[model samples]
Target: MTSTNDSNKAAPRKSGPSRRGAMKTIAGAAAALVAAPYIRPASAAPTALRALMWEAYAVRDVIGAFEEKHKVKFAPTFFDGNSEAYNKLRVGGTKDFDLVQADGFWPSLYFREKLIRDMDYAKIPGTANYFPAFKPDAFPLLKDETSGVFFGVPFCWGSYGITYNVGEVPVEKAKSLELLFSPDYSGRLATNARFEENIALAGIMVAHRMGTIDKPRPDGKSFNPYKLTDEELDGVEKLLIEQKPLLLTRYQDAATLEQLLVSGAIVAAPEFAQVYRLMLEKKAKGELDITVDHTLKPKEGGLGWVDTWLISSGVTDAEKADICHAFIDTMIKPETMVQIGKASGCSTTIDIRLLSSAEDQVLYLMNRTDELRGMYMFDQPSSTEKWERVWSRVQAA
Candidate 1:
C-alpha cells in the first residue's frame, strides 16, 4: 500500500514572486528562473513527454526503451497514491503531464469529473494482451459502463491481505482476519491507517461477524454492513473505540509496517504483496522470519485494487496521444511487465508465462484472479463513503 506523509502539505511556491511582492521581487524572479531552466511556462511542452506515476515504475532502462522506440524523451514524476496525484493535478491546475497512473477504482470517477480523457485503444496494440476480465470496461462494480471503454489500461493489480512475522505468530494461526482486532493479538497487530483501507477492512470484519453479504440496502442507496439500525452503528462505534488501545500503530505505508514487523514491534498486519515480499526477503537473509496468510477470514472476501495508465483529459495536444500510447505499449511488453511486477510487488494483467515461477504465484494470489471475477472490487460510491466514515471512527477512537 502507498502512503503520504502529510496530505495537507502546501504545494511548492512557483519560481516567481507572489503578486503582492512582484514589484520588489523582480530581481529575485530573474535569478530564480535562470537558476531553474527545467521549470517552464505552464502552456509550453518540454522536449520530452511528462508522466506521473507510482514510484519505481519508471526504471531508467524501461524509460530509455520507451524514448528510443517513440523517439521522444520523457520527464517522469512520482506520487504514492491516486488521491495525491489527482489533488496535485486538479488543485494545482498544472497540465504539463501527458499521462498519469491512477488507481483503477477512481478512473471512472475521474472520467466523469472530466479530469482524464478516453484512451484511443487502436494506438495501443498491447491492449489485446490484457486479461479479458481486466478490460477497462470489465470492472463489474463501476456505475458507468462507458467510463471503462479505454479510459485507462491496466498497469498492475493486487489484493490486500495479512502478513505476519513467523517468529511471533505461526502461519497457520495467523490466517484469520479476527486477529486484527483480537485482544490476544492486541499490541501486536498493525493496519493501514488510510481512510479507505482501514474502512474496507473494518467493514469486511464487521460483515463477517454479522454474517451478512454487505449489500447496499434494498433501495440501493447505502450499505447495511451490520444490518445496522443506526443504534447498532453506535455500538460498533463504541466497540471500535474500545479496541483502539490494542493496536501497535495505525500506519499508512506498507514499507513502514514492514519495518515494524521486521523489528518485532508488530507481529501481524493487514498488508499487500509488497509487504509479504519484503518479509520473504528478510527471512531469506536471516534478518527476520515472516509468512503471509492468503486465506484470511470472511471466506467470501479480501480487498483488490487495480492501477491503470490514463491520459489526462486536460491535455488537448494530439502529440500526447502518440506519446501516451508508446508509453503504454512499452509498459505492456512481457519483460517490462515482469520488471513492474518485481518492483511494485503486484501482478499485471499481461500474460503470466513471462514471470518467474515464484512471482507467478505471488501475482496469482495478489489478484485472486481465479477465485471469482468480481468478488472484491470496491467501486460503489455509497459503500466507499460508509467505509470512510467507519474507518475515520476507528482512527479517532
Candidate 2:
C-alpha cells in the first residue's frame, strides 16, 4: 500500500508505468501482466501465491476480490511476529513462499541475503504513488546500494509508542518516555514482550536523555535505534534493567495490553495505535470511562513498522511472478487500501487526499502518527546476530 502525495505530481499515465527511468525486465510475462487489468483465464494456468502474512493484513474481502479477478489463489500462512516470520522464511528457504508480507525491516533478511529477487518497479506502476520513504533509494532495505534494485514494495504501516491512562498520568508527564520506566509508576507499568520494540524504545529514551540522540543515521552510518550496536546495546540494556523494576509485566498483543489497561493492572507502557483505536471504541461504547494519551510522543521520536510485499527468489516462473506483481498493484489501490484500514486499525498507505473521506476509525490513525517527524520504522540490523544476543539478555533480565 504505497502512498500518493500532492507533492510533484507526475503526469497521469493512463497507459502504464511511467518512462521515468530505464526500468528492468525481470520476466517477459511481468510486462503483460502489469499493463493487464486482469489476467486472461484460458491461456495461463492458475497459480497460488503462498503468502506468508498476518491475519489482519490479508482481509477476506480484499483477498476474495483479487482472487476472483485474477483467477489466482492465495495460500495464506500467518505468523505471530516479524521475527518469527523472518525465521520461518529463512529456515523454510526463500523459494517456499511466492510472496511474504513482512515488516519493512525485512530487507535485512531478504535483499542483503539475496533471498528475494530484484523487483521491476515498472511492473507495479502503482509504486509511483508511494510515500517518499517507501520509494527505492529511500532506505537500504527498499533498494540495493550496489545495483540500485528494489527488493520490496511497502504494503501497510503502523506506529508504536507509550500509551498512558490520562486519569493516572498527567498530560505533561505522559509526553515523556521516562514515564514508562519511572519508579513512581512502578508495579503499574506494562509493555509488549516484543524484544526489539521494548529495547528500541528504551534505547531511544536513553540516547535522547544522554544527548546521543542521533537517529535516522545519515550517509548510511551505523548508529540506529531499531538495531543497536554493541555500545548502543550496552546503553539499551542498562535502561531495560532499570525499567524492569517498574514494569508490571510484558505482554504479547494489543488485546492483552487492552485487558491490562482496563483491569487497572497497568497504567502506562508501549502499544500500537491499533490498540489505541480499540480503546477509543470502548470509550464510545461506554465500556470504560477512561482517557488514554498516546499522541504525545517521546521528544526523541518513536519507532514504527512498514510491512512491504516481496517476492521470494524461488519465484522464477513467469506466471507466478506476474501474479505477485498484479497483487502488489491491487494492494495499493485507494479503494482496496480503505477496506484494509477499516478491517485492521493500522494505517493504509494510500492517497493522503482520500483521508477526508475515510471513516472515523481510519482518520483516528492520523492523530497517533507523526511520520514526517518523531517516527522511525523498525529494522533488522546488519549484525542481527550481535543484536539478538543483546536482545536475549534484555528479555531474560
Instruction: Tell me the tens digit of each residue's lDDT in model 2 across 1-397.
Output: 2345543266564576555433455445578777564445555665577888788878788889889998788888888777787788778657568787777566656767767887888899887765555555554567777877778887667677678888999877777787887899989998887777777787788777766666555446645576555566788778888888888888877788888888888988777777777787678789888877685356667777777888888777677788899898888776777777767776755554444444463444543333623466677654667667777886688
Give a tens-digit lDDT track for model 1, residues 155-259. Answer: 777667777666667566666666677787788777776555555556566665665546555555544332344434544566566668778888868778877
Clash count, one per candidate: 2, 2
Model 1 misplaced stretches (Cα beyond 4 Å): 1-46, 68-71, 92-94, 136-148, 166-173, 211-236, 282-292, 296-300, 358-368, 372-374, 378-396
Query: For model 1, what is the alpha-carbon lDDT of residue 313?
Result: 74
Q: Scored by Cα lDDT, where does model 2 land?
A: 0.73
Model 2 alpha-carbon drift over 4 Å, by segment: 1-44, 128-141, 215-222, 227-231, 352-374, 382-397
What's the residue-level lDDT of 219 in candidate 2?
41
State the TM-score for model 1.
0.76
